[model samples]
Target chain A: DTAVSQTPKYLVTQMGNDKSIKCEQNLGHDTMYWYKQDSKKFLKIMFSYNNKELIINETVPNRFSPKSPDKAHLNLHINSLELGDSAVYFCASRKRFQETQYFGPGTRLLVL
Target chain B: DQQVKQNSPSLSVQEGRISILNCDYTNSMFDYFLWYKKYPAEGPTFLISISSIKDKNEDGRFTVFLNKSAKHLSLHIVPSQPGDSAVYFCAASAIGANSKLTFGKGITLSVRP
Candidate 1:
């Protein structure tokens, strides 16, 4: 069974388009996170939610928003995507007390 | 600014030899450190971790050593196999900080037979 899964493993959209990426975890984790890995292979955290509550927001632009409908699901929505938004987005989850994170396969986004 | 740094972009090692990947951090607040391995088209998987209090952690062929004074850490894989080739990431996090991990640009390791 896949512990963490992300939908639409590949996405290609034009500038000014709106897109959303869905993520779900079956590991019974209390925390979920969204990360952006750029072309340089630098992985950075974008947002983190614990039990559906926003806990960490890493100075990301307001155009990007993360919503967690429940403890098991966290989704990312981009408004008016720009060319600079093209990158690999990863979804991760971890238990409240566990330090190790479980990551999904990742979604490659290309905004032309 | 990046808090975690992996100076080496890539490392090539022979099979059955030891592979060492180094990482450094600038933040003293970080209390936990971890190493993750990633393959192409796949997300990173947890490989090993070490706490700030301990200097070393080992799991089978993988061993992580921590130097608190230097704020440096390294992952040592002994007798590396060809299947062990992948990009390795170093991550750090502070306790009670919602477990937010700060990651460094990964280093690619190629284990050649």
Candidate 2:
């Protein structure tokens, strides 16, 4: 079993369309995070949820929203996606008080 | 602004030799540092880590050295193997930041066999 997994490994959609990326972790971690990697390979944190509560929110656009129905699953929904939003989205999780984060394979989203 | 920086985008080393990857951070608040290895089409896997309180931590063939005074850290792989070829990312976090990692662009390590 995968420690972390994301749905729609590759997403191709037209600009202005809405899309959602689903994430799940089997590591039984309390902290879950979403990170975006741009074309330059720069990884930036977008949101973090701890125990089903929003803990960290970067200066990401409001069009991007994260929902954590439970500690194991954290989903990201993007509204009015733009071409600039095309990048790989990663889901990560770690145990409480643990410094290491385990990441998912990643979802490659392309906005045409 | 990038808090953590891996100046070298790519590095080449011969197998069975020593491989050293360096990282620097501008933020003094970072108390924990980590290195993750990523292969094509895969997520990053935690390789090694070190806390600011300590200078060195080792795991098998991997070792991490943290120089807090210099705000620098380095990952050393002894007897590097071809399997060690991958992109290594440098990450840091503050103690009270809930371990929210700040990642560098990453460095591609090539261990030529």
Native contacts matched by each model: 0.80, 0.83
* Each model's DockQ score: 0.81, 0.79
Candidate 2 per-residue lDDT, tens place, A1-112, comes to 9899999899999999999999999999999999999999998999999999999999999999999999999999999999999999999999988888999999999999
Docking class of 1: high
Residue ranges of candidate 2 with Cα displaced over 4 Å: none
Q: Which ten residues in a row have the lowest lDDT in candidate 2 chain A?
A: A93-102
Q: Which stretch of 10 consecutive residues in model 1 chain B shows the poorest summed lDDT?
A: B93-102
Residue A92, candidate 1: alpha-carbon lDDT: 99
Residue B110 lDDT (model 2): 99
lDDT of 1 by residue, A27-109 (tens): 99999999999988899999999999999999999999999999999999999999999999999999997888999999999
Q: Estimate each model's TM-score.
A: 0.98, 0.98
TM-score of 2: 0.98
Can you write out model 1's per-residue Cα lDDT over B1-113, one digit (the tens) per residue? Answer: 98999999999999999999999999999999999999999999999999998999999999999999999999999989999999999999997748799999999999999
Most lDDT-accurate candidate: 1
lDDT of 1: 0.96
With a 3 Å backbone cut-off (N, CA, C), the pairs that clash in candidate 1 are none
